[model samples]
Target chain A: MTIHYPKGMHHTSQVTNMMRTGKTTKKALTFSRRGMGLEEEINVANDFYLANRLAVIHKKPTPITIVNVDYPARSAAKITEAYFKQASTTDYNGVYQGHYIDFDAKETKNKTSFPLKNFHQHQIDHLANVLSQGGLGFVIIKFTSLNENYVYPASHLIYEWQLHKGKQSISYETIVTHSYRIPESLTPSLDYLVALDEWLAHINK
Target chain B: MTIHYPKGMHHTSQVTNMMRTGKTTKKALTFSRRGMGLEEEINVANDFYLANRLAVIHKKPTPITIVNVDYPARSAAKITEAYFKQASTTDYNGVYQGHYIDFDAKETKNKTSFPLKNFHQHQIDHLANVLSQGGLGFVIIKFTSLNENYVYPASHLIYEWQLHKGKQSISYETIVTHSYRIPESLTPSLDYLVALDEWLAHINK
Candidate 1:
């Protein structure tokens, strides 16, 4: 398994790509007692792996340019003024068994196709850069209405998002043809890493 | 080997603990580089890990509760109004081996001791929760002036942090006595996992 981060920094990507990250999709979920976003689901899965002594992976903090901090007490510093910084990479990345894993996650309710608009050019370029440097790059897609997910290689998404710009979107069939489908289950709800297993079997070699 | 997260997704304590997390006292540094911040260095190291296929770890996205989003175009949504949601756990975590590894990175300019104010009570509680669930937890400490790094198990840090509200702060000697000192080097400047290797050695036995 390999994940790529190019030029030693965060890779900037699509705008929608930034907002609806992992479980952060904004269609206004009904607030399930168990309802979590794709990002949160991934976090819970990562926790499942961690609690079982399986892996280490976490979310990045918002890169805050904290301009004003007040140390009112000897021990406490309160951040008073801050600005958000643009990230240069996908939403999630990490290392496992000498393999680097990099990915962005998106969720859509359309249930027909995944819009290429969900990804950005920098993300595509970053993926290529990672692949060039010998790493694994992918995206996890979820059609929440259908409760289905797929692991699409960044290479494939980049090619389509670039050369096929006006194509508007990539259909479910295209995803099935080009990506690895993930299974939904307990503890690790969306087991996309298992899709990586397929990638390893077929692509990484 | 353990880290604790507090209830209700409140992350103030953990964030505080991470900022001033140092267990040992060393000579004060004469200079400081802008890149010495824990998040940036880990980003670089994570890139290295990804490029080299060593591990896959990512910082989760900043949790936000969006009150409003503007649909500029068909595909993009701009977050016009949003508040940072308290993270339930630390910003960094991931998977290595079949074992789960999770941690936060902290840095301090002080020479002799790391302030406890860098961490939050909630963060400590969270690490303990993570450990109770059977996760490998720790913190990466960087002494900028000394140009040295150390990986202290969360179990160790939590133990001391809890005991120290009485003492005002943990002693440098106590930190050095309880933590794993990290030596700086090439490949990964603060390769704190070497300390984790020692921790795992004891745990696996």
Candidate 2:
């Protein structure tokens, strides 16, 4: 039976989509190679950085409110009921070179523009708060169809979100102009820290 | 039937203990007031700081490995099966005054010493990593029986944990000497940031 799970909750949906297409051609192979979710790519990069002692970043677990549990005699405790809770902060945060880094990762299939709806009000508020406290706050946006990624400063995002400009979203051209491009690579799939360093250097200058 | 839930899993157990004792005297009232769990007290303090824009600290939600979810028609998705997962890092962390702050809260009933068993190996390693990254790392320890709270540096905790000294825990006297005392108050309850400032000054000096 098919189930309609909330966004970010059902990872299996991506797998299902792949299975339905069932294309084994070269283009399909390339599609599968680049089809990894943004979250997974970030996790892999984090693991690499952690192992090398470069930084200690982590993705906060999805929040859930547990209501009931069952414990058997010789097994692990099992949660019988729970519900997801809306997150008040961004998904990723940690310390990097004495700097507090906070950001949320998002991906869009849109070819022309990135929708502002991808960001929640609380997340925007959280990034603003982190920035006010002198921490570095940003968002990692991936244009899936175009296979492009950008590390956009949270300050610009907040401005764009609140500006009520005729456009409800940020055009690709604006993103390319305002954000630092994250060159994709093999070792750290996302290689976002490079973009982060650039952003940091730009702000310090 | 009584269930032996793991530590930090059953908050209701504290309430159960209170109900079982059935104490309503003046002394019991005092006990209840001071009996608020260390986690809850820290949460209250964090809320006060956030409201006043003093800090952006947050307690991460407990991690759970969800296995099954069910979505009923016109209703929110329900987590049908899940299991608690061991945390990979500290519980509370955020930007404080441009300093990346990371810490875990723990309480002990023993009056003489804080047991090393109260800390997990991963937590110690995580603290060490954060400290190495130039972030502020510490543990908020509460001696429940004594109604005393301390903001103890993670450096000291790591030292004692790895020293293999004759004792299995840090003596109360040692903690008093190396830690900053957090005085309880009405609004914030646990004013740990004051202790943190003191720690920072001492380290800088």
Candidate 3:
């Protein structure tokens, strides 16, 4: 007696076998080379920091309101219906060496400017509130097209946000002038802490 | 022609009318006097604090994974299927007065002890991690039956948790001895910050 598997299934099994044997196959190589999104890279950096006990930052979960649920036999309860709720704060916040850190990670494809529309008024207000409480608040802007990232302080963003009544965006040149560039690395992919240290030094000086 | 309303609907409308007219109907008055659940009360207190710019604490949204969704015409997309994801940290965290505050608000009807079962190992580990990073980590425990609330610092809780290999709960006496009593108030109802200030003062002393 014999069993047959589909071609795709056989291919996947071969890849799994290669991974188990520590052999880098074409699929494995492609997976390794695949570029993560800005959020994914930041999450990976957070995990690295957590494992090394350097920081304790986390992305806040998306807000949602469950309307209906179902309990299946011998399984986890499933949400049958839900609605997204408006978020009241920025994306990431936590403590780093006794300092309160809060920031949002944003990416843009446009290389010329980063539109202010990427942020909401409520988010700006929340960041201001965080700043007033003496916490560090900033935004990590990734210009994907240019393969560049910058840590723009919340204060600078707020200033531009308030002044941009007629303007719709912050020019890339202005961002380059005012923000600290976040150097990319292999282990902690987006080392925003370096930028944070520079910003702290500048403010203190 | 008169629009007919159901009996319950009419009763509710009358109660609402009484509330609007500043006339306290029996039902309306009872509703006003009824105590809110611990979570609801905390939420109300958070709103009050935010409005008054006293604090910036917020409850992290429950994480969920969307498996299916439906986009209806001219309306928001509805999550048709989803599942709750395990949270990696506590419920509430934010900056207050240059301090990073992280905590979970819990309630137990048991008048004698707080069952350690209310906490999970992951939450404890997360709290420890936060503490290592110099963040203030604690739990706001409400003895609902006793109408009492206490802020139990993470260090004390972790000490007991590590010592209690087979113990199922922490005695009320233990909590009373180690925790700071959070006096209830009208505006910022929970007023956990008052307890926090006391804890900080004691530690500094």
Candidate 4:
């Protein structure tokens, strides 16, 4: 996991080289960027978007069930016994431009393909349910090794999951062809909304 | 409180009287209904709505911040230290008939007015933000003494909250005049969606 942290010296050197050459390739640009976790990036982006009043989105807090709580004088109540609970819906959802938006973000170390096992049956079902209600539903997949992220439509994922028997993964090629790449950017950091807009336009067509 | 629970024998006797007379008033109906908490009632209604494919509403789990966890061998992770966190948004939100729905539910024993103190500033801000983004935002108020529930639009609540300086509450009279009543029902228990539908129709007019 430490290895995944941005190599500070190596990254700085690459930026210096790129500056001196006055030209940089996409790979060089990607390598120069820090390897922030997908969830954190999205959260930062959400905060930025919210501050700008561009969209009202939130990552639902992780669900937990509590068995006991202790109260002390003049202090906040402390949970004593609790366990994580499986979420029934996606991790993220809110309203954007009058459209209901819902999605989950996942980061995978696999470079060749994204395993379907990363998604739970209930989440897939939840996405399908939201879609039927005319809401936009999707998943953000970050290929950690490749340092790339894509916004994959829940409809497409559900189709593949249901249509195939024992086929356990979606290949990188298929993902690249079908999904919109979320570009790395400043301010909002990871501008997934741009990818979302592109996907929305494509689907509307 | 135990006093809040529906009186079993007293309630049964009332029902028996109503049955003997073949006349059940609205008050009788309200009294006969179990005194389930507002949150629990909404959860039950949401479950019914989900199962029937009528709506995709859900009660967002109570937010908590965990500080420590213990992993016992061959056992699920146990949360050892945690504390509740104030939620930034409403308790319930989802999609219904292509409309984004967002709201919080509160129950009060006050027969005259619903106290504004029931809401937090952030929750109010969140509702305003979502409403601006074209989502339907509202608060559901259950008058425990009256056994009546009303869906009060966030627009009205926001207006009152902003306009009235030092005013502490919204009178029940104003609520009844301006909001839709959520009726007690069979399949979905407390059918707030029907009130929502009515509210939507009224607003569209």
For model 4 chain A, where is the 10-residue window of minimal lDDT?
A1-10
Two-chain DockQ for model 1: 0.07
Better of 1 and 4 by TM-score: 4
Q: Interface-residue RMSD per candidate?
A: 7.8, 0.7, 0.8, 0.6
Please provide TM-scores, in order, for all candidate models, with all chains considered together: 0.51, 0.83, 0.82, 0.85
Per-residue alpha-carbon lDDT of model 3 for A4-49, expressed as tens digits?
Answer: 2222222222235335535444345335425878888788878877
Top model number, DockQ? 4
Ranking of candidates on DockQ, top first: 4, 2, 3, 1
Clashing pairs in 2: none
Candidate 3: deviation at residue A16, Å? Answer: 39
Q: Name the runs in model 1 displaced over 4 angstroms.
A: A1-86, A92-103, A108-117, A121-140, A144-171, A174-205, B1-87, B94-101, B107-117, B129-136, B143-147, B161-169, B186-205
Candidate with maximal TM-score: 4
Query: What DockQ values do the models have?
Result: 0.07, 0.64, 0.63, 0.65
Chain B TM-score for candidate 1: 0.76
Predicted candidate 4 versus true structure: per-residue lDDT over A81-161, tens digit per residue: 999999999999998878899999998999999998898889989999998888999999999888778999888889878
Q: List model 2's recovered fraction of native interface contacts, to 2 decimals.
A: 0.82
Global Cα lDDT for candidate 4: 0.80
Estimate, for each residue in B1-205, the C-alpha lDDT of model 3 and write its tens digit: 1222222222232235345536344345335425877777778767866776767899999999999999999999899999999998999999877789999989999999999888889899999999988899999999977777899999999998888852689999999999988764434456676678778778889
The CAPRI category of model 4 is medium
| Model 3: colliding residue pairs | none
